[model samples]
Target: MDTVYSVVGLGKLGASMAAAIASRGFRVIGVDINRRAVEAVNAGQAPVQETGLEELIAANQKRLRATLDHHEAVLNSDVTFVVVPTPSDERGAFSLQYAAWAFRKIGYALKEKKGYHLVVLTSTVLPGSTRYGLLPILEKESGKRCGVDFGLCYSPEFIALGSVIRDFLNPDFTLIGEYDEKSGSLLESTYARILENNAPCYRMSFENAELAKIAVNTFVTMKITFANMLADLCERIPGGNIDAVTQALGADQRIGPKYLKGSLGYGGPCFPRDNIALSFFARAVDTAAELAETTDRINRALPAKIVEQLKPFFHKGATVAVLGLAYKPFSHVVEESQGIYLAKTLADIGFRVVGYDPLAAEPARIELRDQAVVLDSLEECLNQAEVVIIATPDPVFRRLTLADLQDRNVETVVDCWRILEKELKGHSIRYITIGQNINDEESQARLIKLWGNTDANSDT
Candidate 1:
């Protein structure tokens, strides 16, 4: 493609996109305020760590380059993609402090360019942010009209951190919130050229696109919460299995199998916060997002509830090993992780807790501090524990053999994902999960009394 692409921000997502776009035979320029990140990219190395990012950047160095000068990137490239941080505020709204600063830099660059430049905002924001929040800054700074001299589009990337390159290249659909027809069409064609797969694009106004981006994450959180709710119900029902219930529920076309599995609550950088931000937005519009509010409450309460469930399994002084400290497998991010909350609560309640993850050990250490020891070795964590919690559905933890726990003093195992059910069935260790009934006398007696023949007794 003749059009040069420039990505502002050299973070994981931005660096990955610059590399991916260059791989598709486009000359790409990356702009970042960090001098170290800029130097890293220009030296044929990845500015940040991600799956296959270093290799991809190294391979595409001839086509891709990075700079600290926004003017250099914008003046040289036809399209500039802004992917700066939109961190959550105290009230759950996305703070556009970083985005506004980045846009002002691009605005100065746009002032010098004579040709039409399409500036795309890929940062997550609420409705009216692009039109009402950012567009005015660009217009005032550049001293030019948007539709006439420059173009704008609010097109956020729907991608997970670990698999950003692949997800960006092959999305279910692309959403384009356009300032005008000219800008949106340019972006649509650019995506068509960049994407290996011919993904369909959904075009709309700026506000619609902004709302849609947050809505997708919020809706998925609700689905995850619903599945988690069923898991709690399964624990009380006779012969109840959450897996079976969700499987049947998923068979209906109205509900798909994705995110329907009953496990720990959803967490990461995005899902939990999106629900809160949407609720905040709803309140700003003078309405109540009761469902979202409830979902957030239930997810936040899971760690405490889980600790209560394990009260009978171990005493105060016993050591507990929490496997998989990251929010998900193949990722190092521990932001809003359920495993973090679980480990902290267990340690707070007087249990000595040690946690392990394949990628997130160092960051987990910083997050947990003295509350729980973050171990670098899974073997060490497994070896020094009386109880083990399979906190995430990591493949490494799933492949754990009975021999791995042989020399350990572990008396009980709580498998959140139920991956060890078959392996631990007849073992000497006590195996318990969230979804299935354990044939406990207390639960059975409680059910019997609740469903007793009250009418027959009253007649007598």
Candidate 2:
């Protein structure tokens, strides 16, 4: 009498979604091509490394199970959610090869099953992909008419890697792209039961939903770029503070402060590629996505810009330690990580670069092999460094005291997030905060030069 769920592809997002659904007292069947992933799920363990994922899976073992057989999953479950990776191709578009394969298998399973089944695509793809690219495969394989014998929906999740479980269960809102009214209503009802927060659902055509997903990510990147631009301007102006400026800007109802932090450029699995894909889509449609293009260019140039800023402090053959190889704090994912990019960029420029992360050391090591030495411990990295750059504001890095830098004989410390300003300032080391004016005298001189000084007593 209840809707049973089957999630295809047991990656980070898929496994977490499956576990979260089952935790809410629903039966879930997970399908994956990887034998190890399936085995891990069946053994009441997490297939991928994510925060709180293993515990969630172990607690809901009775309701959640995984299998290699797609047929078994589709036949048993009422709805199947395809969460496969739609990796970006060389052309800057998401290649739906994996999604197509998974859809074909599900379509074959639907052919044998003699009941109404719903198929939902949770993978990120370009607009016109779900309906034009993937839907035909389903109709052909299943030999069934859509909206009659079966249903299809495009429903991608808005989640980050480290906090997938929490974000999935309590999204601000859900986007549902439906083939027909029947399929949309069914999914809306299912989400109503699963979501912890009474999140609003936005239902529309498949193409609109696909465009909306990428549009949301690109818009966030634009905001992040705007904040970074502000940080650059703050560094140039005397007594300019990014926090003060953004705080007031955020006070306005139109520009609420989310992702408005003037920190490092965004880099993860999603933001970078999504922006590029939107640009590519724009070009295809004979429209100019100059803003998206410029945002990406700025974000990509951030590492080089930081390197240029630190070049003055770098001495010949000096060891420079980079803290936080992951893109963000408390994450192991190094995909397009700005920290890793900084380390590699410095290494290429002949600075003896050493990198460290709390959890992403191993992956960063593989990424920066022979370019920079990826150290295991934070103390080890700090010990052999003449200059240290705090790339991400990790909690461990925040707890750094005077003892850490004073003992290391470090000459310069660049705090990208400005987290160590209070503790590190006025110390022996030259502390530089990215968004704050380092030299007031120099900035004041430039300001006076730009506009002829008019003293208070001498009015023009």
User: Which one is best on TM-score?
Assistant: 2
Off by over 4 Å in 1: 454-460
lDDT of 1 by residue, 1-460 (tens): 4999999999989999999999999999999999999999999998887998999999999999999999999999999999999999999999999999999999998899988999999999999999999999999989999999999999999999889999988999999999899999999999999998989999999999999999898888899989999998888877778999999999999999999989899889988888898899999999988888898999999989988977887976999999988999999999999999999999888999999999999989999999998887888899889899999999999998777776778888899999988898778888889887776576777888997746765755
How do the residues 311-411 of candidate 2 rate in per-residue lDDT, one tens digit apiece? 98778889999999998988999999999999989988889999899999999988999999988899999989999999999999999988889987788
**TM-score, per-candidate, Cα-based:** 0.97, 0.98
lDDT of each: 0.92, 0.94
**Who wins the lDDT comparison?**
2
Residue 417 of candidate 2: its Cα lDDT? 92
Model 1 residue pairs with clashes: none
Full-model lDDT, candidate 2: 0.94
